[model samples]
Target: MAEEALFAGPAIRRLRKREGLTQAAIAARLEISPSYLNLIERNQRPISARVVMRLVEQFDFDPRTLREDEAIGGVEGLVRRFADERFADLGIDREEMQELLSAAPQAAAAFARLYDNAAPASLAADDPFAASRREIERWRNHFADLDVAAEELADEMRLSRGDMGLALVDRLRERHQLSVRILPQEVMPDSLRRLDLHARQVQLSEMLSAASRNFQLALLIAQLEQRDQIDAIAKGARFEDEAARGFFTRHLMGYFAGALIMPYGRFLRACEATGYDLPVLLRRFGVSFEQLAHRLTTLQRVGQRGLPFFMVRVDRAGQFSKTFVGASTARFVNSDVSCPLWHVHRAFERAGELQVQFVSLDVAGEREGGWLTMARTVEGRGEPGETQFVVAIGVEAVLAGELAQARGISLRSDDAQPIGPGCANCHRVRCSQRSLPPRGRKLHFDTIRRGVTPFELASS
Candidate 1:
């Protein structure tokens, strides 16, 4: 490789920053020192092939992503090396250095660097979400490709044709002569695709509760029976690189996993049986509340859906780890998506209460412009104070009317008094709940806004 060969440092560094991590944080993820990390990031050191292998395994980076020709070169990589909190007044804080080194957090420091890197870019944009998105577009692209494939498969499988999942499943059983079994978590994980290779049966685990096990089992059977066909569909995509391709593969796999849990037809029945109530579905399907919420995102199996839905689960920080789009019409902002009035935050407010929400855009959607639909709350399963996830599900403008529960709700996306993504990204102009000024617009610097919403958005 040439001396100037790209080490993918910039790309990797950008990803870490977007996730709000630092070199020391990355080192912690790999159990190394910041000095060692500095050397590697600066290209003063080269990440051993061993470390590269570890990055893929640890962060789920595609091994190919590391093979690019970009130099660990740019000043950012150097910035990452010297970018210690101890020197922050000079853009790196001195006191924070000791903690960063000793405590060795996995991502906090890296996130700081990202702010330094993108802050200027963000300030230039009236819309921080658009800028933030540019920085992490790869992540979205990966999901986009997979989502496209999933949708196509959904269409071909005739998911929208009503009870299509069962019809396809039935056909597979008849043709492949495969048996389907549903076992509880106690008996078996949520599901498995048993493929015997050399007499070694592959046990694919779904980590589902009992009743959910049955629902997912049927889906897995359909996926398995069509495994080759699905693989072909995935391979047919026009991917940019192996790394991007691999991440998408994993995501699609997750979708299939979800489908198995809530096979189209039966799930639609359960949706009717329980009035599309997630809690009721969880109990009926014997799955976690999160699992039930996640499964709902896959309702695009064509004709069997109750209503088009988009599932979002987040914390107060506006960070989203799970996004399921069951309906095309409903869309979510990709960067800095925190909202207080949004059902997700409310879910956290009523942490354990299974409140059947009837929110329209005005009730929980953005409080400004566009059509929006939302449902939110923090749900519990294990013991108290054990890291329960705050969650919310929603439908965007295009499919807003398809909502089964949106009767007499806000008609516009921003009808619900909208909130901003944490103070970091929301552009809502006068939200009393402003956490921080939106990531972009200059702060008034007058009557200290002192709010949770971060933006000076258009509406109020």
Candidate 2:
């Protein structure tokens, strides 16, 4: 019964405490008497709809929790409340029950619904997407600036070119005092790691496949070995999405793996040594092309991070496998939207035919920008499996040097296509192929003329 309050009196009291406001303070803000506000907060007088709205606006509390009492089961709470034997003995009192429900309103209904949610009944359960989303968000914030860490680490470890895998192992043992091993896959059983931080020793079975092996070992070393450093960098980053936070977390584990496998300074020199050729680096390092590509995105630490590139890897169908950005790439402001008319689709037709293209981007509250895009298709999995076109999408401002090195075709400045992985989330203006309007904007149509884009910016 205590938990059943739609806005529970106790929760309101707690909210006041959290904000460090007395009843009088909130009452003044609401232009209500302190005594009246106290009554509503205590569940003595039911909250008015106006107060519910005001709580949402003032405190920025989740509307769903605020309306929990007004939800579907809340009305039934009031019905059951006065459903005494004497009232029921009066026989058919359906109209009376309705009147009682009307008096209780959203509070009763919301309480009932929330009660049903918390109930251990077999059939009904609330979906936990929100919790999962939050976890994912936390992870993203955890590893937002891995590239910076990797770059700064290059000098501290005294690593200069050569085999990154071997050199990183030597440094980890000497500098971090963490033991490194390359156990054969068959040697260890089910367990991946056995850590004793007091002893500062971690033994991981090399039983993991190529990607998994590198990933697990590096993450363990990062967390147990350099937790404070990683956490410090992550704590300072400002994240926009919850899933991005989770992504940052999951990706950081991998970032540590990359740092371990291909230490920054050595890897940067290797990129220059091999001229950023994906296959050459893979054959030399025995890592997957995808892993190498992921490393390219994290090249932004101090003086040594390679070209500050906005590394986006998408296949023929416009599926993004990985996305990374450096400080220089961050400065390449985006047009709150994207265009789909770009020639990336042709890469699917002309598989393996490397193509250079030009695109225009308009940043909101700013002017347009230019970019050079490099796109190509690569075979995926094995021979029988379908060939894939992995396009390395990037901007022109950051590409002058790379363009000069690999000059196949000049990127024309006049062909004003815009960048877009897909239309549903794009924010470009006047795009004929726009399937949806940019998020956070109201789409309005005018009687005089229809815009090329399906949705037009609404005016004040």
C-alpha lDDT of candidate 2 relative to the true structure: 0.52
Expressed as tens digits, the lDDT of each residue in 1-460 for candidate 2 is: 0111233455567678888999999877767789988887766875644564466456634323333322232333334433445446666354755554444544445545455445444322122323332343333222335544655665566544354455556665777787765554456555666665677766666554455445565666567666666556444445444554455555556677677567666677888777666557766666654566666655544334354345555665565554444322222222222245666566667776655666544332222334555566655543323566465545333243343424554444343455542555444456677776654345688989977865886641
Against the true structure, what is each candidate's TM-score? 0.46, 0.46
Listed per model in order, the count of residue pairs whose N, CA or C atoms clash below 3 Å is: 63, 32
TM-score of 2: 0.46
lDDT for 313 in candidate 2 is 56
* Cα lDDT of model 1 by residue, 1-460, tens digit: 1111223454456557766888888888877788887766654565654464356446635433342211121222233445445545676543554344323322434544465556465454544333333322333223333344444555555553235335445545565554444333454433344554444333434343344434354445435544665566456655545554554455456556455444556677778665565556665545556666666655433223344445666766667765554332233333346556555555566656643343322211223223344444543333334445665665433334334454555454233444444555444445666665543344444356554443444321
Among all candidates shown, the one with the greatest lDDT: 2
- lDDT value, residue 419 of candidate 2: 51
Model 1 — which ten-residue stretch has the worst lDDT? 68-77
